[model samples]
Target: MATKPDIVTLEALDAFDALIDARSPSEYAEDHLPGAVSCPVLDDDQRRLVGTLYKQRGPFEARRIGGVWVARNIARHVEAWMQDKPAHWRPLVYCWRGGQRSGSFVLWLRQIGWAAAQLQGGYKAYRRWVVQQLAELPPRLAWRVLAGPTGSGKTRLLHALAAAGAQVLDLEGLARHRGSILGAWPDGQPQPSQKAFDTALVAALRRLDPARPVWVEAESRKIGLVQLPEALHQALQQAPRVQLQVPFEARLALVLQDYAWLGRDPQALARRLQALRGLQPGEVLQRWQVWARQGRLPELFADLMTRHYDPLYQRHLRADDARATMLVLPGLDEATLAQAAAQLLAGGLARVGS
Candidate 1:
């Protein structure tokens, strides 16, 4: 006899063989549980059709059409994604709010003799958990803010720290943005939604050890489209800092290498540059576009630093007295960065200056 499977909570995720999401395709693309697989009961068009029916015709008509779609889709999913599963294989399924879609999917799986369960409160519940984690988790761990200018390789050093077995939380990487107007990807790759960014941030924090300090960049209140949770932003502010200072020319070279994509599409680059219009003098902006047109990236980059980024850094990122350590690197090449990283890790501000 097929038995009814027990319902599970979000906390039970680890015990399940697989976590399946039964929302529409568009829903899954925005964000889902960190590892949940997409098994939409109704695809994007089907979902819209059902909603339109519910709004235009009546609940009964919508159900009649939706039920057929759900049934056929679930049948295909079980046969394709779950056919080889052992009889004892257990899976947890969820939809938007533990409603009809997940309920029906679980019922069918149970009938097939698989120990499947539906999540209580579904994706909404998981999202709540992520939000709570963000509000609480940052306070639980010590933080080390890696402070630097726009092109000081702060992101590079964070990765290096992690590779050296130090803990890291790469907020920019999580946001899919580099945290500047010029920071977006060259081909117009979009940043993550706010909720998507929160989920990713929580997942990253969960992997870290509480006893160790987390190193992060000196980001502003926001990183592109997503703002750091209020408490986490506070934590970034209060953390001890490791300040890195490099000459303007070195940073200019570094910025050029990092943003070589500007040359590929000068028009897009010019538009992004224009965004600095009010702050940059009209003559400077005109000169920037001219150099960009001529592919004079080096001079343009140098002017941007001396003219734009440098003033901003001095006003904002510079610490008056609490500099934990300072490094004036001659250059930001790999070897020099590695040496500087070693110095920071070694916990000694041995007064290195080129």
Candidate 2:
């Protein structure tokens, strides 16, 4: 006879052959296990309908209606999504809280002689582990902070550093954001949920060598919609720093190059400029808006830098203990960045005076 499904902790996830997520699609979109497949038993609409039924008619009626919905969806999922399962395929299943959803899925899988287990405390347990990691992980890292004005090639430099075999934890890249008011990518991809950000952050941090310095850009505590974990943010604030000093005109050129997509639509550029109104004087803001409306990107960028980005950047600099190194470059071109990366790799902290 087949036995009941075994229960497993979040720590034993690797022992299973596969991890299956049975939460609603909307829930999965927010975040899930790093490799968990979405095999939702109830889609978003069905979940809302079932929830409403439970509130009005009670759990009996809710289950009566929801049971059919869940059964139908699960059958379809097995035939279409899980048809390749081998006889010995053992999967770990989880939902929001290891409740009826995961319990029911594990029951169905076991009846067919598959070895399946429900995660104890479900995704919530995994979330707790992530929290513990964020608190503990940053301390283990040997951090080297990169700071510069808005248009400085901080992110690009991080990419170059990683490519040169340096250990790097790119928090902004993991967040899918550029870490500013215009931080959103031009193509309109949404930033990952906070949990998703943290999950990816922890994974990235674990991959780095604690013995070597982990390179990161200086960002505010919050990057776009998600905030950095408190411990990591604090570590960043106190880490030894490197400042990149690209020439003002060259920095403007770099900013235009990096954000060139924003200049494609004059009106769209104007709309973005409006965000700086409160920070800039009325006349300065008006001129900037007009410059944007006319697609005068260089002039608009210059004005924004002098009137906005430069001044605001000072606030960030004030928080730094003192920069360990200042790499002044003629520009932020590929050659300059490569040289800077080499210096970082070969010099270590002693190169600060150079």
TM-score of 1: 0.94
Per-candidate TM-scores read 0.94, 0.94
What Cα-based lDDT does every candidate model obtain? 0.85, 0.85
| Predicted structure 2, TM vs. truth | 0.94
lDDT of 1 by residue, 1-354 (tens): 533446778767899999999999989988999889999999999999999999999999999999999999999998887888999999899999998989999999999998889998989999888889999999998998888787888988787777777888999888888888788855778998888888889889989899987888888988888899988999888888878777767788889988998888877778779988899889999999888878889988888888788788778854552555675677777777777667778885744434
Please report, as a residue range, the 10-residue window in candidate 2 with the lowest summed lDDT.
Answer: 345-354
Residue 270 of model 1 has an lDDT of 83
What lDDT score goes with residue 189 in model 2? 86
**Candidate 1 — which residues are off by over 4 angstroms?**
1-5, 318-324
lDDT at position 72, candidate 2: 93
